[model samples]
Target: MDHWSSLSMGKNVLMERRERADAARNRQAILRAAEELLRRHPPEQVSVERVASAAGVGKGTVFHRFGSRTGLMLELMTERARELEQAVTEGPPPLGPGAGPAERLVAFFAAVAALAARNGNLMAAHEHAMVTRKSAAEQPREANPIYLFWHRHVSELIAERRPDVDAGQIAHMLLGTLHMEPVASQLRAGQYEGLAASFAAIVRGLMGEE
Candidate 1:
């Protein structure tokens, strides 16, 4: 190519790299701000405007990046669950690999319960936003990456333990419990141990184990 054309292409590439870096920084800042606000206040009090002010970004930027409050909350949930996801993917047994299906399923439930307990406010806000979004859209719930991962994991375990049953539907039922307001309230109240135990019992029954 000509020298001028090569120079213009190089500049465009550099500009794109800078833009990506800036977007990444903005995303992290927004998430951190949102998390802090959720920790300090009730869900209703933590608005996108406040989060934008805290993150030093324009309000429109938040919407542009996340689509809506529900999208932002979902992104935050995904961020918070990253560690648990990694553990399930590659960490030690039970929570990770090399355990029986029942044992692994139990461990996964316990981990999720603990995570919910720790982020009760965030979870509540997410649920509220989700409800609002669902009503406005009047459509199926948006696909959540974290939920998809958990659902896939649960379905695989259920299938491994009981090949005759409908693992996908069962997985949906199991996860549906976690989204219930009562369950979320229990989690926020630090009843994760009981919740986990109850889930374990249910899973055991489903697997035909004593």
Candidate 2:
């Protein structure tokens, strides 16, 4: 309405935008730090204090942003899945558009396996929580959201290359190997050599190719 009032409102909006941008930047930093820590240490060894220190943020900031350690882990897991989803949907070549169905399937499985390996302990912690719920009725009846998404992607790729095969079942089989627990087990067992190639071989085998 008035000049000063309008100017004040505009300044307030700009301040709000700046705060949101800063918050987003801080969140990304924390996630990056947490991922690095998880790579170097087990999930139990990671903590809000450590993540905040590694990210160069205040402990209160970590708590304020994520609420708790479990909350942070869940957000990190979701963020990792979101990144993969974005890559497959919009990223380059094999993971995105332009590659043949077989190529895409191989790339997709490899990417998924890599993501799972990186987030292994964090995800396995979540899976343990899911199973240890007091009430089985309160647990999710459907598959984990990330798993369902991968399953759908794999199924679509399989359908494109081999429509006659049981895409759904075959997708499930491939994904079983890519699960966080299984991949983490393999990695811990020092069996990560040529992991991506193994995933490709499995995909090719599922496609009934030589």
Candidate 3:
């Protein structure tokens, strides 16, 4: 319309773009700071204030972006798992496509176990923070995005191989065993060895393979 109006609209659009870019940069900086803190100190020691200072942002910014430490941890978990999720969605077989359901299931569980083993501390911290949040306000574990993705994938694979049984319930049962605390404990105790084979045998049994 008018020249002045067009100039104002362009400025607003530019401002919005800059805000989004700044938010993205702040998010990555916070996550990286939190990760380094977790590596150096225990989860309980890593606070939002500490992360804010490390990321060179104000504490209010961290709280505004991630409601609480639990939220921050969950976002970090999602970030770390993003690559694995992408691989499952679009990468090669058996982790991706082009493989039987049983094989894919096995690969998926093994990959999850490996991820957990590598990030045992982060997993444990996330679990601890989640528990603390749950005590104050009930938050359903099923609502977690990462868990939902894994559950959906497992359910589909199970349903493909065993149409009679309740794939959803079976997927839940299997995922329960792979939860953060138990998997972290197994990793800590050095008992995580041979986990892949164990997972494969269990998957084959569920698939009714010989």
Top candidate when judged by lDDT against the true structure = 1
How high is each candidate's TM-score?
Answer: 0.89, 0.69, 0.90
Candidate 3 residue-wise lDDT, 97-129, digit = tens: 999999899999989888877777787778778
Clashing pairs in 1: none
Model 2, which residues run further than 4 Å from truth?
49-71, 78-87, 90-93, 118-145, 180-182, 188-191
Which 10-residue window in model 1 sums to the lowest lDDT?
Answer: 134-143
Clashes of each: 0, 0, 0
Question: Local distance difference test, per candidate?
Answer: 0.90, 0.77, 0.87
lDDT of 1 by residue, 1-210 (tens): 999999999999999999999999999999999999998999978888999999999999999998888888988988889999999999999999999999999999999999999999998888778766744653234267888899999999999989999999999999999878899889877689999999999999999888
Which parts of model 1 are misplaced by more than 4 Å?
1-10, 134-142
Report RMSD for candidate 1: 2.2
